[model samples]
Target: MIVAPPDPVVLAGLATTRPGPAGASLLRAGLHARRLLLLKTLLVRVQRHRETVAPAVLRGFEAGWLLLERAERARPDVVRAVLDYPTTGAWLAAALTEPLGPGLDRHLAHLELLAVTAALRAGVEVDLVVDTPGGVLPLPGVGRVESGGAGRLRIDARSRAVRIGGGDGTGSRAVLRRRANGPARTLTGSGPGWRGLRALPGGATRLEDLDPYRLPPDMGIPARAAADHADTDHAGWADRWTAARRLLRGTDRERAIEVGRSVDAVVPLVPRGTRAIGATLSAAPGAVLMTPSAGAADMAETLVHELHHSKLATLHELVPLHRPHPPGRAAPTYRVGWRTDARPVAGVLQGVYAHLALADLWHRAARGSRAPGLPERWRVRSAQRFDHVHDQVVEALAILLESDELTNEGREFARQMRKHLASLSSGRRALA
Candidate 1:
């Protein structure tokens, strides 16, 4: 029989990390967490279905459910806490199940997040693995791990290292150091996934191989997108990808990896006129589509922007942040700092949350860059970036606060967001 971990003990780990730059931009993450506990307690009065604990998208995760049931029996409170966060458990399950097309890496990352976070909450070393063609690959989100193959990952949470091989148990195995610094390198084989970050061009792996879904219908269909622009005339794609990687590898590497752990794939689309630099599918949780970027920072910001959409899309599957817009009213849209056109409330929220992430990344990137000789403008620009994006975020939050579409819970979320954003900018004087 699985033994449940005490809630107070697991909860201490949650308290260990607070919201803001220190713990990464899980901005106001605690609000939903606290709200979830309250909601779950109330839901016990009206326990709907066993499926209520999981999202519809995750219904296919039969294997994960088996594992999760074991986890639940062992740590019911921890399981409930992970489920209470709108997307954690669902995303974890969906990742395990291969809910959409490619993105095994994305799925594994979420699984790692679930395992590690649960362990923290449970105050114990938790271990789990995903069944792959080769063997069962470990999922230890906490510590350090290198991922490759069909998203094959080996993370060492404390002393627990992943064993790689077939079910027959005849392949190689390696241990990882969780706190080791510098670039995390993957042991080579098969195609790229998370390890695509470290893979070389013209290798066996192609961008399309890693990100198989070229045109996700949710983002609307487009044409003329290339894998890396290496073979095509679109040198711009190659340049942008290179620069974005440079930024990730150099200054923003650690945090970018932390932020991008949720991203399943980054799909670049051929630019359609002067609109939309990037898009993320609401239906497909981890895929992000991008147009040619203006620069490395722009590309990084775009990833941050679309990742917010990806995250909310996952959470949205579990909870309704706002009531549907009035059926007959013309779809009203609001102005966002990043967009020239007005957007609907949902789009506005996506943009604001995305900007919050962007602002934080830039703030950290400018100050914490390891490489020297970054433009003076970047240091000055950090404050400017924060001001512009924070203003937009505040503006969007105001609308969300005033809208009748928001549920009481939604309003509280917005209130928390507003307060969070305010606290972030509380110390800033007017930028010159």
Candidate 2:
């Protein structure tokens, strides 16, 4: 695959946290292309290390790859849906990073589940056996199936219908349908051992199941027991998300479009009062782990903030924004004014980029009646938020500009960020 460098103009726009429609499209295309390359690399690595991997796992992976390839030829869109899911990239990163051992085999074998999902969605005929050590088959974007016992799970798919049977004669059947004019595929299951996936009210994002590879490795949550408690409150979650989407579209249609494109799923976290909590994993491009307690405005803001992180993460993968810390030497850290602890240069860069967007968000919110039906108190709070985030962004930008750890591209990016912040500051003063 030919990898093209990101356009400098697009990079600059992204640094300002305002990649317009064209820039956003370019970024998404670049990210998708790179992910496809990563998938190919993963397949080759598994093939190279076949001896170390378990025979069953190896066979599963090989069969899955063939099915995936055939599905891609038949329905590239369906295959892309499975491959482009955020957790697929995270799983690939983990599988590639680990050494050749049981851990690696387990990670690599996840590709079989992913491939099966694609085949089912594409309506390709496939009868494949996959190892489900714990009797649970967690399809990446689809729902999970519990076989009631740990052993081999046989999946037979023909014409968009799939039947999953376990060694103990337990079985279930699900029908997959590709939504009209949308890339999302829905699966409805009957009989025992099937838990269908649920989407938020707008159907734009999936409430992701408890897939072990869903979270980054650093989170350290156990796979089988990592089910989210927030799933119980789907009604409330959907209501807030619908409101959040409205608020976002009201605030800025372009930004709302960006968020919609950037995020595919929300891994709901247990609520912590009314405080909003959100996190994005560099490995997982389109997934956000967020609590469900936030109000519409707060949820909207969190989505925007996390979208910046997601964009920057994808950009970093394509272009080196900051150099890694010197080997055997501790990386320098600095206070970015948002977090209590001092952060490394890379962390500071991420903070600066995300806060820059937040500053823009509140700046627009505070300036007159751009957001229709916004309460007076909301405008007042928006002004306060703008002030806080603007200051934090200024402090973080200074750190980024002064750091020697940045690449030439990174320095240029920081300079563009500083210029953009100056523009926003001038606008604030004009409003005053």
**Which candidate has the highest lDDT of all?**
2
Output the number of the TM-score-best candidate: 2
TM-score of candidate 2 relative to the true fold:
0.91
How far residue 338's Cα lies from its native spot in candidate 1, in Å, is 4.0
Give the 10-residue window scoring lowest on summed lDDT in candidate 2. 220-229
lDDT tens digits, residues 7-100, model 1?
Answer: 3322222122112243222323433454444434323422333343344224324334444556566566665544433334334334334433
Residue pairs with backbone overlap in model 2:
none
Off by over 4 Å in 1: 1-206, 209-212, 217-254, 272-276, 326-332, 335-337, 365-373, 430-432
What candidate 2 gets wrong by more than 4 Å, as runs, is 1-3, 167-184, 217-231, 272-274, 430-432
**Pairing residues by index, what is the TM-score of model 1?**
0.50
Worst 10-residue stretch by lDDT in candidate 1?
A: 197-206
RMSD of 1: 11.1
lDDT of 1 at 51: 41
Task: Please give the lDDT score at residue 209 for candidate 1.
Answer: 19
